[model samples]
Target: MVLPGVYAPQEDTALLAGALSDESLPPGAAVLDVGTGSGALALAAAARGALVTAVDMSWRAVWGARLNAARSGLRVRVRHGNLFTPVHGETFDLVLANPPYVPAPLGGRRPRGAARAWDAGHDGRMVLDRICREAPALLRPGGVLLLVHSALSDPGLTVGCLREAGLKAAVIRRRRIAFGPVVRGRERWLRQRGLLAPADNEEELVVVRAELPV
Candidate 1:
């Protein structure tokens, strides 16, 4: 069960989960899950025999994830901190992230609670951009990073960022989904920003995978 202020597993979460399942994870692989809400992805990785670390900025998420892991009898390292900060200097075999990518007017103030889980500034790249820039450093040779975000945030930009960082990056999956409350509420603002069309109510979620050279 998701605790208050914790992001529940939704379509994008399921998409990432499915992709994680399809991956050929080496036994006891070192796995990192950034912005791991509710510990779903991290637990899934643990269930596959991977050594998992899940990070989030919310204390609630940290506690919730730890509780969930303990209840499931899975070992997971859950830390509360901004994305990647708590795990600085660590390299992993695979990194997974499903960060906030909803476009909204954030007013230059850091959001709180549920809004903090989804709002990503006017262009929705606030967090996604940072993830793309920093995640590669946390990967070992031949390690892979899987990131899922709204297509409206421009998934290609992410692939480009990873590629620029010397990794092989590409969009591995895309799914069209109806706008969630966060997106729907900002429809007018998004349209004004030219990110959404007058008749558009759906947004595409894209999963970009980047692999470091072995």
Candidate 2:
């Protein structure tokens, strides 16, 4: 779909597919799609008959999502805000997110454009942490939270954080993607900075699901 002023890329499509393929999702659910870059997940959920509210930080993204939703004949409420700010005090039956998971380098300039889209904070869990922390407050009783992120960001840490937040988190899906090139680049930078160990050459994209306590 044409996303107006925003750029469409393969990664966004992959993320959408990963999120929409979750079998745990209930039909006719009220869903919230956080960081809805191009509204892909939101549109897909809407197509499944779910009432979808999509949130994005970029005004461009919001407009693009709306355009795509209209073109796809899917009903989605697109809002512009950071994380859950736009939906404060609102709750949903399901929440899905494909947050930025790449950790930024130590003392270096951030990459531009779509690359900037994927960089999380230093440990790559900045957005993830906030999402997990706020999720319990935004989910209905027995509601589901689905998140797709990189294993490079420390999946165990993510799961632990979610659990600490009182959510029952479990890995429901995982796929290893080749990242030899990424590893090479990161390794070079790390070595130059006197850091030890080679970077992980492969990244595991995982889908984590959590259910609110009944």
How high is each candidate's TM-score? 0.97, 0.84
Give the Cα error of residue 101 in candidate 1, in Å. 0.8
Candidate 1 residue 163 C-alpha distance from true site, Å:
0.4
In lDDT terms, how accurate is model 2?
0.76
What lDDT is reached at residue 74 by model 2?
82
RMSD of each: 1.0, 3.2
The parts of candidate 1 lying over 4 Å away from their true place are none
lDDT of 2 by residue, 52-143 (tens): 99998777888889998998888999999889999999999998888777666844555455554576766777788888789889889888
The best candidate by lDDT is: 1
Give the least accurate 10-residue stretch of model 2, judged by summed lDDT.
190-199
Error of 2 at 24 (Å): 4.9
- For model 2, what is the error of residue 175's alpha carbon versus the real structure, in angstroms, after optimal superposition? 0.8
lDDT, residue 147, candidate 2: 84
RMSD of 2: 3.2
